[model samples]
Target: MSRRLEEILSNPEMQYLINNANNIENIQKYLPILSELAKKVKKHNTWFIEGLARCRVPYKDIEKYIDLDEILIDNCSIVGNIEIIRQLRNQKQDYQDYYVSSVIDIVCKTSEKTLEQTNKIEEYLTEKKYKYRFLPPDIYVIEFKSPNIKIPNQFGVYRYIDTEIEKQNLRIYFLIAAENNIIIRRNSIIEVVYIENFALFSLLFKFYRYTEKDKKDLEKYEKSREGLEKIIDKGFHEKDLEKIMKIFGKEERDKIMKKIKSYVDSHPDTIYKKLLELNIWFYRAY
Candidate 1:
């Protein structure tokens, strides 16, 4: 077998399909189309293939009706198979919502130990006139939506903590809330699960549409931070400082560096503390 075909066969999802197939020989004929789909999706494309299988699309003619574009548009035309494909497409959309809701359910379940406490805390917050809402239990957990944090066109679970709350009770109130929430940030799918004492953050999916400006901005931001740290340790004469400041452009270079140096000298710990603060803000905002 060719290297690419071998790679596809070795994929865990593909292996599962192969090992469980009623006739392995029938699967072989579909490999070329699967390979092409995988290339288009930049992954195993198991979900698409499985959808076809579930619809009972014929192995010999699967490629004739279904292509990446048709799959994307949910407009595949299969003779005498239109109804099944239509149903599958509807299920595919519903499945996305179902999948997100399931993840939120699992995340909420992790905090079951603190649910009673959370309810009590919520009551207290309510009495104190804090702004919040409790979603239907079937859909999501109690949500303490802070007016302080808002991101347009995104939905996520957020933990709200009032500094006035007693430190002992703070842990109980730290609960994430939102059902079927997913963050789609600039062509990337960001999945974040936060329980009382657990957290999982990952870039779950990418659409590969990063622009040149985005890449340059990210690179410049990272390099500038690294350069600032070196300047803090080794002083203004640091050799690479000039190169790093050039990223900011000639007009703002000297003024910006001077301002940064002044702040660093006066409050050396601010940088570290600000990073932690930003993380907290991100968790609350998203």
Candidate 2:
């Protein structure tokens, strides 16, 4: 990774939330992304973390990380409930003649408990040496990718805070890399979800992990067989192939694309089924 990407991923505040993620529900009400991000952490070998929502001052070259003292999942939940109450009390009824009946909308639909998924993800990533970044709380958590903590600079959120929930309004500036750098704005109401609503996040995480693992394993095995063949045909012998494949670096696998195609032709179809599912090749050559 480049230094800028690394620095962003290793930002202390984001890392702290990942390192010490909270599982308790109430605290999630406070900093809800904990649970949502926890699940994400469990899914892919991507992303970084961030924290300290209340502090508005931006630090330049902040040598240290900013984070909550503890997981605070439960505390955040309590904060969410409080915010709800505040919203109810602050409802506007400008005129007795013009009072209109309206249904209250949930600012965040996720339960505080589910928000801990972020912590789990952090634990998983730290173990794998992957990277992530928690965009400043001012930024919305939008456009979640499998195994990543990326937010486009353009995904706009209403971007405010409700003191009771300590939940800041997040309008995700989710955009494709193509749309990120340019400066035109879209006013359409794009559906947005906050960390407070962590339901089903686990499912997304599980699917992502399963897919990533499959990709890695397929690449590793295909590369192994390729090396074995080279041993038989080239200068090296079978013994050399055995030794080399055994010492393969535990990497996510790429450069071995042709090795995978080889399996489709010369090896048993079952051995290559998983790779076929991953779409590693645009079309499997016979």
Candidate 3:
């Protein structure tokens, strides 16, 4: 096997996905496409290529195999649950990088956790290499409101503490891409997860390692997998796209366009999938 192919398939999570085939048809349907991608476009996008392997079947490829929304709506037991799942799936339409939802949504829906609190929240954020910015208790009042720390020209969050009341005391604000500013006075933010120009697929490798030794214990393995499915469903954020644009580094239009064209030419199917799904033209300005 080619080294790239070997690298992609050697992943224990990918192997588990293959072994736990919901049906032979899912495997028969998407494996060849993944194989072709592993063999052909391996060099251009190691991150995404590996992601394809981690996901086993990218989102669109899963559609080629099964209609997940329809299956849930048809087969689910409760009416309220079906609506909730439908809404959840709709919210995740743009972020559906892979076929994870269909396989794991059942496990997710049964959990008592809210949509925001997926199990092992800290672990996944850690895998993404997020830098946690914890403010001192009076951080917002002293920083943003009072100007103690000079804010950098980058993305970050700032807040103010309202000691006037016992509850609802924190007021949160954010600087997006170091320019667009926002403030949230009502809702409390548990924490901020931030990673710079990070590839979404990298999480899969970490997830794989987390689940590698649990094959003998089916329940633990499936629970971990369910948590991962929640993370995947959150998908890549709009801010992440801005970060992704920096992949090739900043340069003149002609140079950037050339690199993008080369990428699109070399990885037609993958690029096409991204363009169609995300409505992003990574090749050129126009």
Where model 3 places Cα greater than 4 Å from the true spot, the runs are 1-133, 136-251, 273-286
Q: Give per-residue CA lDDT, model 3, range 147-232, as digits (tens).
A: 12211111122221111111322221111111112111212111122332122223322222324332222122223333334434
Cα lDDT, model 3, residue 250? 35
Instruction: Give the per-residue lDDT of model 2 (tens digit) for 11-91.
Output: 664465433322222332323333333344344344333322333121111101211122223312212211222222223
Give the Å shift of residue 202 in candidate 2. 16
- Report the number of the highest-TM-score candidate: 1
Candidate 2 segments exceeding 4 Å error: 1-114, 119-217, 222-263, 274-286
Clashes of each: 0, 49, 1
Candidate 3: Cα lDDT at 55 = 19
What are the models' TM-scores?
0.20, 0.18, 0.19
All models: lDDT?
A: 0.29, 0.29, 0.29
Model 3 C-alpha lDDT versus the unseen true structure: 0.29
| Residue-level error in angstroms, candidate 1, position 238 | 35
* Model 1: residues with Cα > 4 Å off, grouped in runs: 1-118, 129-132, 135-175, 178-182, 193-286
